[model samples]
Target: MTAPQRPRVPRRALDGVLLLDKPLGLSSNDALVRVKRLYLAKKAGHTGTLDPLATGLLPLCFGEATKFSQDLLEADKTYEATMRLGIRTTTGDAEGEPLDVRAVDCDEAAVRASLQRFIGEIVQIPPMYSALKRDGKPLYEYARAGQTVEREGRQVTIRALELIACALPDVTFRVTCSKGTYVRTLAEDIGEALGCGAHLVALRRTGVGALTLDHSVTLEALSEATQFERDSWLQPVDALLSTFPQVCLSDDDMRRFLHGQRLKLSSLTIAAEAVNAARVRVYSAQGRLLGVAKPGEGVLAPERLVVTTES
Candidate 1:
């Protein structure tokens, strides 16, 4: 006899962000799916990606929070990584196939000096095994097909780099950098500068914008928790825009702004410093986060608007 099917859980609309401590071996999307299914979330997205070889803070957004997820992409990031000297890889990480190996001739002094050369503004050629698109296809696809593509060098800023430990063949370091900075490329570049090639062996992102790993919860922890426990872990949607200047609009203005109308800057109480900002967070007088706006010609024009929850 055929067995009866169990009732399926209905996906619910959930709003807020989850600071997930994404475990290694799962791509950012893989981790997001697991967490979304756990919550039965109707919609969800990640602020940024963490490779399967990386493990650390990956903020997942659900419902309204997803609207502001793009903001974090431009936020500075901090990572702690370990690179093996005298070795180069196809993917620039431990997961890649080793291309070559040599002797580790450089000491900590040499490593430190090499790292200094990468500090501040520097250019990097995006790796072929990256997600960068060429002709509507990811570069990784081309790489898997054994095809090489010429990529433009991008300028990225390295805010700081601190060597944590130097254990001869293995070097551990912490780096704070601007958006679009690739730690793997930095490791490879430093390796080349030291007269020996290197590739990332271990990597953990500790910070993104204002969020830190300390505030993140692991998938294992979430699995054991009840629905209420999971709900409690969700950060307010506005948390994603903490770095942006905020303006609380009046009830009339809130309605107009929500309806896609622009507001006069003279009528809104805006900080002088924020007037020239590229984007500003807009909120309702009742403390509800409205959305984001772009300042122009003494007016605040709606950019990305949040859909208000139904009554």
Candidate 2:
């Protein structure tokens, strides 16, 4: 019999930040490239990496939004993970071959107690299948060639690790942790404490900083939606940097600031008190975003000018 032809994926400009409800089985970068083509964006990047076995809120930044990736990356992340007990893998997830298996005798109370070990500030050694670099190459590359190397445990905070469900060999938990935490490592450690080996079977990121899965759209939906429809999903660039102080300029001040001139505030009419030359969000008199600015001695000096009066 003749082999059937595989269907080709269509291409389309993916701009702005896309809260991708990424499906399982695709790598984070894979999803980013796919979304990039959809928006025809000149540049694109992802806030964080999600394993192929994981699914959930993967924020894809396009165009000038890529510059804010560092802020998004530093934000805390939340995940809903399923840990399968009685077996351990080299990779720490289901993608690897089983290396060992232990008899499980874990109960709900026991599982909860075991998880407590991971809570608060702790150090964890990342798995071999991780993207952590060693001598300009990913550790997973060495792992594939049957090479094991020394990996130092780095400090990562586990703000909350609660057992959502426990059924002997299978345990589900919600972990709200700091950046760079590996749930797979936590799963293995939990299994070891319970006298059983375990590995992560499923994982889904529920939130990243302020962005949540609730505000995300799936790739399937994006593929069917038009450019105009897709553009509606973009939250303003300022939305990502809400932590900065805001400054509302008068009409004349806005004009002066846009024309490469500084606004001298001798009396300090800003809404924020105690402003001493810090980066602030600049907006027009009509409440339109102008961009970020740095305040000097009685003057508003723009450091990173984005939009101007013409814009």
Candidate 3:
């Protein structure tokens, strides 16, 4: 017999998501770059941005996984925040210089009741010191130049806002809300509600979509662990996207799908309303993930096929 040949390793061995329990003092991008280095990932990006002072769940997408991040980014988020009342900062948090201060008396009941007023839908103007853009320049640039511009108020839904503790001017609260809701601005608004100005002192993201801090790993631990340990923390790319329906096809159907051919619906069942002419998860009959498909009317078309035969 001829000498046996060793198989070649794939160019990119890693793919999927990483739920990082980001430490305080690292910007979201900074954490992403470091994690990318740890995995030697060729392509990586975070689903959401976290401020330097905040810490908690930051989902990093690697390889083909980055394509699914948009949906995750839009998912509802939960946060635990501690705000210092009686003072407001220019950057809306502790990073900025103290802009205003006022002494005030506050009670726990009063604080809890005040938080109730902010529940439900409300309009919030983007802060000047934010990354919002105007004339192709970040609003923070204008803020640094002492220039203020008209900012349209955005409707943000707060699912729940509760005061966990109120010790004089320092108050801690938990908020579950839709995407785009700014916790820092909420803190300032809460301070205004309490007849005093306030700024965020400490804030941590507890959950994003279905991923939570409980399932996340710290950067330090991940850095020191073996590849097997690190890979265990990856949530399936589809785990956070269960709301979307899934469609599985047979081998023949998958062949057609790989050729970018559209087929009439038959045995597969997906939410009729969910099956628009858009991309969706595709799998084989054995429940192996193949890729995504675009379905229209009663026809299906493959978008990205992740099928593997040798595996």
Candidate 4:
């Protein structure tokens, strides 16, 4: 006997930003896939990558929101991290085998002083277990093969680093840093400063730019929410570009802008300083978001244009 097959549900055209509270033990992409399936969205992307060992706020973009996700990637980030002093790991986190261990004899004042030394621009050699590439392959591939490669030290800023608690072997801290800052490496450096090697045991991203963990929903919660409730969690596509200056255009200008034509600065309802800014959000006269633009010598050039339903 032949049985009829059920039809697959069609993916919907969804657009917005989701502040997902990524759970531990799942890679950022894994979490994204689960979220995508839950929403049945046609297009999706994440602003940054978080290791499986980390749990925190991860910004997700759907449809038009993906176009501006790069903005969030370049923004500063904040994290709450717990490092195990007196121990070093091959991967810099607890996921790897222990490489070394020493006595933890440092006090609160010493730990605070050690954190102060990292509160500014510093150079770091990217760990071999990172996603950074060398010759088109991830460094972790080389790491798994027991290979070592020469790496260059790059400059990164640590805007703020504060020790929250000093519990001998376990030290907890909060950090606010510029893009590309590696907290695991910071933990290792702090350990070295205290005469005891360390490795990150726990990490939680608290904030990215204007997004915070307070408003994020876990995958479990999303899975149980109604369709309308899931959709309610989505922020407008323009939410990612909230920090950028905005300019609303007339009907004629909106057409020209969408056509990839440059508009004169005088045509935009933006301040002189805003016109001088590198990037500005574009909007239609009807208050609908158009896209993003770059300020040129005397005009605003289209960079990324949003395709609205009406368009």
Candidate 5:
């Protein structure tokens, strides 16, 4: 006979965002699982994927916060990366075997000039060993099978690419770029520009949207904290929508919004300029975040609203 099974603990309906300092070698999903289990959260998601080779700030969304998580995914990202010159890897990073090696001959001034060339808009051909999918399968799967597929060059803006340090074969730099910018491919391009092929050796994400590494907690710390203490680390749901304009409504109007009704733009007390925005965060008079709304010519139509027990 099978032994009696233990009772399962009910997951909590938690809401908020957690800035995780993801450790090297841990995939973002694995880290999210740990945070979810630690908080006993019923719903959870991450703003973006941090590769196993990277280590740094990874924002996690719980419950209501998940509603606005997509906003962060489209925001700018910042990272400090180190690339080893004179060596090119198949995957464009240290994780891959060296495909080519040469002597490093570029100076710091030359590195600075090369960085300037990528300061604005640039095009990149994503590597084979990436999460991009084709025919319902990730390109990485095709790469593992030693197959190459055609990938078009995508236009990605490199808002800023500043050199941090240069020590012969290894070069460190900080980059701020728009969403979908592949830094590994960037390092390879820069290396080729310098006449010395390179591969990424280290990467640490420091910022996403308005969130930064300054207010992040490591997994090790969360493991040692009490459940209540861990809950305190979560930012309010509105944190994910910081860049969006906010519209506060009365209890009665909030009820109407909950029922998928629209309000006249003239009825709102916000500044004239804000009413014209594409999206706005809707909040109840009692300071509760209701959800989001899109402004029409004269009406504020509900876009994505919070899920409530009553509705």
Candidate 6:
């Protein structure tokens, strides 16, 4: 006779964020689910989506940490990308079918010169094989059916783009850019500029805002650790808001703040040069992070308040 199935373990309520070093070939959500199951977290979400072909730092938010994940989503990102010159793909990456191939005759100097043209603010059309929606359907769905859609070019800033290495057909580089920047499109654009088409062969995200890959933990490492050891990898929820300026509230103000009430500027321990109508990280007198608030006129209004239990 077959043994009866064991009872499922109860999921524990978990808070804090995990800097996951996502592995290649797994979608961001798939990776999040695996990590969530490992932690037995009651609530969890990823800050941003990474393509299955890409790998590296993926910030996973849990419980109250999900409240401020938008901060990281809006933050700038850095990546190390490898592009194969002379070959273009339908999806702009290696996963797609090859579309075209041309001779690659450009040297490093010519390639470097071409990359300079894309350094500043430039308009880029979103790729068809993207998650962008059109009339309630993803662009990729239409693309899969061999349909083409008109896409408006969006202006994105490329703060830094450096060519790290160039070996005939393969060109590797690093890029630091604002949110919404598409590196695959960038490779294609650069290839077009060099008189040869190109497609992304490999991509790895190295940094997201203030978070870097160095502090991230891999799935294998988490899987090998004990439950308590895995929990140790989580950073406090407030770690997401480290970039925002802080404002401490008095005991009375803290009480009001927690109740979702507005507080006067006089009640806050703020800097004299604090900007008006600026978002500030709110904290109690004990230095515990309360949440995020916005300054308006002479009052501090709650934008997102952390649950006390999670705090």
Give me the candidate number with maximum lDDT. Answer: 4
RMSD in Å for all candidates? 1.8, 5.0, 5.9, 1.4, 1.3, 1.8
Instruction: Give the residue spans of candidate 3 off by over 4 A.
Output: 1-11, 270-280, 293-296, 300-311
- What lDDT tens digits, residue by residue, belong to model 2 across residues 189-212? 888888888999999999888778
lDDT of 2 at 210: 78
Clashes of 3: 1
In model 6, what are the clashing residue pairs, if there are any? none
Task: List, residue by residue over 1-311, the lDDT tens digit for candidate 3.
Answer: 99889985344556688889999999999999998877777788999899899999899988767877887789999999999999999988999999988987777887888899999999999899889999999999999999999999999999999878878789999999998999999999989998888999999999987778877899999989997787788877666556656887788876677677887775556667547635678877888766677777677766665534532
Query: How do all models score by TM-score?
Result: 0.94, 0.84, 0.87, 0.96, 0.97, 0.95
Q: Give the winner by TM-score: 2 or 3.
A: 3
Global Cα lDDT for candidate 4: 0.93
Over 248-279, each residue of candidate 4 has an lDDT whose tens digit, in order, gives 89999999999999999876678876788889
Worst 10 residues of 2 by lDDT: 302-311
**Comparing 4 and 6 on lDDT, the stronger one:** 4
lDDT of 6: 0.92
Cα deviation at 43, candidate 5, in Å, is 0.9
Instruction: State in Å the error of residue 67, model 3.
Output: 0.8
> Of the pair 1 and 3, which is ahead by lDDT?
1
Clashing pairs in 3: 290-306
Candidates 5 and 6 compared by lDDT, better number: 5
lDDT of 1 by residue, 1-311 (tens): 98999998999999899999999899999999999999999999998899899999999999988888878998999999999999999999887899999888999999998888889999999998899999999999999999999999999999999999999799999999999988999999999999889999999999999999877899999999999999999999888988888888899999999989989999988897678888888988888888899998999999988886621
Error of 4 at 260 (Å): 1.3
- Per-residue CA lDDT of model 6 for 42-91, tens digit only, reads 99999999999999999999998999999999999999999999999999
Query: Candidate 3: lDDT over CA atoms?
Result: 0.84
Candidate 1 local distance difference test against the native? 0.92
